[model samples]
Target: MTVGTAGDPVDRSRTVGAVGERRLIVELTRAATADDPSTTADAHDIVIGSGDDAAVIDTAGPAVISTDTAVQGRHFRLDWSDARTVGARAVVQSAADIAAMGGRTTGIVVSIACPSDTTVGTVLDLNAGIVAAAHGLGGRVLGGDLVDADQVVLTVTTLGALDGAEPIVVGGARPGDVLAVTGNMLGASAAGLALLIDAERRGDVELLRRHARLVDAHLLPAPDLGQGPIAARAGAHAMTDISDGLVEELITMAAASGTRLAITSDRIPVGDEIRSAAAALDTDLRDWTVAGGEDHELLAAFPPHAVPSGWTRIGEVLEGTGVLVDGRPAGGLRGWQSFGG
Candidate 1:
C-alpha cells in the first residue's frame, strides 16, 4: 500500500504526491547517472546536458536516430510488469530502431510521465531499467524529462552511428535476395501473453509456474540488438525486426522492397517451450509464430551468398509484391498497427 525511506512518516509513504517534481528529478537523475556513468565518450559529447534545459550531442559520422514510446495500459500493465521492466523495455524498443538501421547506438534520452500517486521507488526502479538497457548495449542515457501524467508513459530517443556503412532501410531488398532471420524465432512473447491471459482466467498457480518462461518472455523481452549491425555488415539489402507480428513486418519489408516474399511455415522455428504452451491452451503455435508480435528478432534480406553465419534462411524475395506463406496469400496473418486499417 505504501513505500518510503526508513524512519519516514508512515503517512508520507502512501503517495508520491509528497515529493516535489524538482526533488524527484534530482534523485532520479542521480540514480540513472550512477547506472550509466558520464565517464563514457558520449557523455562527454554533451556540452550542456541533463539538469539543464536540453542535451547537446556531437557525432563524428552518420547518425541514425529513433524514438519509441510505451504507455501504461496500452503497452504494459502494472500487474504484468513492474516499473523496472517497463523502463527497460521502453529503452530497448527504441534502441532496436537504431539497430534496425544498422547503426552503433551511442546513447539515449529517456522521457517519463507518471501519475503523482506513483511511488518514488517505482520511478527509481524504472530509471534503473532504462539505464541498464542502454548502458548494457554500449549506450548511455544522456538526459531525460520527468512529468506528471495520469498514468505511466515512457518515451526513449536512441542515437547511433552508422559506422561508415550505409543506413539499412526497410525497402532495399531486391529480387532473388535471401530472406533470413537473426535471433530467436517469433511467438515466444505472444505465447507468453497467451499464457498470461489463460492464467488470468484459471488462477492456477501450478499452471503459471509450468508456463513461467512464456509469461516472463511477454513481461520482459530482450530484443536482439546485435543482429542488425551484423546483418548490415553481411550486406543486408533490407531489414526490419518482428515488433508487431512476423507476418506484419514481413509485409512491410515486401512492400518496401517492391518484391514478393515467400515464406514456408515449416521453416519458422518453434521451440519445445512454445509448442507446449500452445498445446496447453489448445492454440496453434504456428499461428503465434506467424502472427504474434514483439519478439524483436531481426528479419533481413541478404544476397544468397552473403547471408552470414548464425542467420537462418526462412524464405526468398520474388518479382511480385506482398507476402506469401507457403505460397498462400497471408489474408489472416498480419502485423499490428496503432489504428485499425
Candidate 2:
C-alpha cells in the first residue's frame, strides 16, 4: 500500500518483498511476546503471553480493561506532531479510559501500524513516549505489534486493577448528586491546532506554543489519575473521562444513570490561553469548553458534601435525561461523536 505524504506515494511492494513471509512471522512473534514489568509483579499472575496470541492476568481483585485508538489525520496530524508526542497521546488516551472506571492502570499493550517510509528512529521515539506516559500513570507497556499500513494507527489497551473497590460505572449516579470536574475545560489541543494551521494567519508562533495544550495535553494528558480513586473513596456516585466534550460526556452520564445534568457555562473553567486563541480564531470559547473533546479530564458526581481535591463543582444531577446549561436545555450542538456529521 502507498503511504507517506498526501501527494507523494511511495512504492511499498518492494519493501514488503524484501521482508518476505518468514521475516513477517518472526517480527510478529517478537512483538507478541514482549515482557512487561507488571507481568512479574508479585500482585499479578500472568496466565498467558503474546506467544499464545492473547494475554491473561489474574489479579487479587477485579480488573479494568479499556482500549483507545488514534489514527493519523483524524486524531492527530503527523506534520504537527512528532512520533514521541503521538505515542504519548495514544498511551494517555487509553489511560484515561481506565481512570474513568475508577481504576489504577497496571499494564498496557500497544499496537502500531505505519508505512515502510516511517523511520526506525521515529518508531523508537514513539515507544519512548509510550514508556514515559505509562510510567507517569504507574503502568507499563507489556507487548505490542508493528505492521505496514497505509496510515499511522496506534491502538492501546490498558489493564487496570481495582484494588478491591467496586467498578464505578456510569450508571451509578443518582438525582441530586453534584457534578464536578478535575481539570480545565475547553479547547486545549484544538487551540494548539489552530495556531499550527495559521501561524502566518495569526502571526503568533509563540502564542500558539504557549496556548497549544495539544502536544502536552495530547501527549501527556493530566487525567488526575488519582482524582478518580479519590472521588470514589470520597463517595462518587458515577464517573467518566472527558474524552468527548464535557456536555457530551455529561449527557452520557445522564443517560446511563437515568437522570439529567444542569451545568452553568459561567462556572466552567476556561483558561485565558484558550480564551484568547478562541477569540483570534473567531470561535466561541463556550462551544469549545462545553463541546471540545480530548481534554481527558474526569467528571464525577458526588453527594453535596463529598467534594474531592482538585475538583470543582460545576453542576448538579436532576430527575430527567439530558443536559442543560443554566436551567435551560442546552441549545445548538450537544457534543462530539465518532460518526456525527
Candidate 3:
C-alpha cells in the first residue's frame, strides 16, 4: 500500500508524542515502503506487511533468523551520525549474521523506542534508511513496533532463506582448511571511529577529508553481503561474521573447530585508507588492523583449492588449539567486549 511521495508535505516540527501512535505508524509505513520505488517489497513473497498485527511471508525452504540491537550513546550517537545512518547500520548488523549462515535475506522487522519528544522527521529518516538497506538485500520491512523510552533504541530482526543449501556453521573447519576473508578491509570501521573522534576534537577538516573512507566505514559499513553464500557454494566448511574484531573471531573459530589458525601480520590486508588513518592518529596500525572490530566481513574456512574468488587467503588451520600470529600465540584482550571484558 503506497502512502505518499518522498517530497510530500508533513509537519516536521511536531514531536512523535504530539503526532500520536496511529499517525506515527502511518508515517513510518509510508517511509518504509512508499518513499521510493526501489524500497518496495515483492507482493507475492510478502503475504502481509506493515499496518497489520503480524507479518506473513512465503518461503521455499528453511528460514534463518537473527536479531541485533543499537542503543543511543552505546552503539551510536546523534552527534556522530544522522538518524538514517543509524537505522541502516542496525539492519547491516543483523543481515551479516544471516549471510554468515549462507542464507538469503528475506525480510526484517524493526522495533524502535525513543523519547516521546523525538521529532517525526527523525523517525521517518530512520525508517527510510532501514527500508533502503533491506531493499538493497532483496528484502523488505515486514512490520514493527515503536514505543516511548528515555533513549533511542533500535532492534532489527532479519529473516533469511537457505535455498536448499546446508547452513555453513562455525564448527566444521578441518585442520587442513584454508582460512580466508571477504575482500572488505579489516579495522577500517574502528579506524573511522577513531578518526571521527580525533577530527572532531582537533577541528581538522583536511584530515577528515583525507580519510573520508575510514569515517564512512564506521558510519555505514557495506559488507560483502553476497560472499557468504558464495563461500558456502565454494565448499566452505566453517564461517563467521567479523563484527567483534578479527582476532576475537579467529580465537573463537580456533576453539570451535578444535584447530589452530596461524597467519602473519603482513598477510592481513590493511588498506592504505586504514594505514593513513592510523598514521594520522599516531597509533599502532595493528590496533585497527588486528585488534579493532566491526568490519562485518565474512571469514570462512575452505578447502585449499576451493577458496572462492574475491577472497583473501589469510591463514591456515592446523591440528592444534587457539590462534597464532607470526608463529607465536596471540595474547591480550582484543576487540569489543560487552560489560568491559
RMSD of each: 4.5, 6.3, 3.5
Tens-digit lDDT string for candidate 1 (60-150):
7777899898999898998888888888888778888888888877888888888988888888779888888887888777788878899
- What alpha-carbon RMSD in Å does predicted model 3 have with respect to the real structure? 3.5
List residue ranges in candidate 2 displaced over 4 A: 1-56, 200-206, 210-215, 331-341
Which segments of candidate 3 are over 4 A away from where they belong? 1-9, 35-43, 332-341
Q: Compared with the true structure, what per-residue lDDT tens digits does model 3 show for residues 206-293? A: 8778988888889998888899888888889999998888888888888888998887767777788887777778988777776777
Arrange candidates by lDDT, descending: 3, 1, 2
Candidate 1 residue spans exceeding 4 A from truth:
1-14, 37-49, 332-341
Model 3 Cα shift for residue 69 (angstroms): 0.4
The weakest ten consecutive residues by lDDT in model 2 span: 1-10
Model 2, 90-194: lDDT tens digits are: 988998888888888877878878776665556556776777777677776566667778888899999887787778888788888999888864456555655
lDDT for model 2, please.
0.71
Question: 96, model 2: CA deviation in Å?
Answer: 0.6
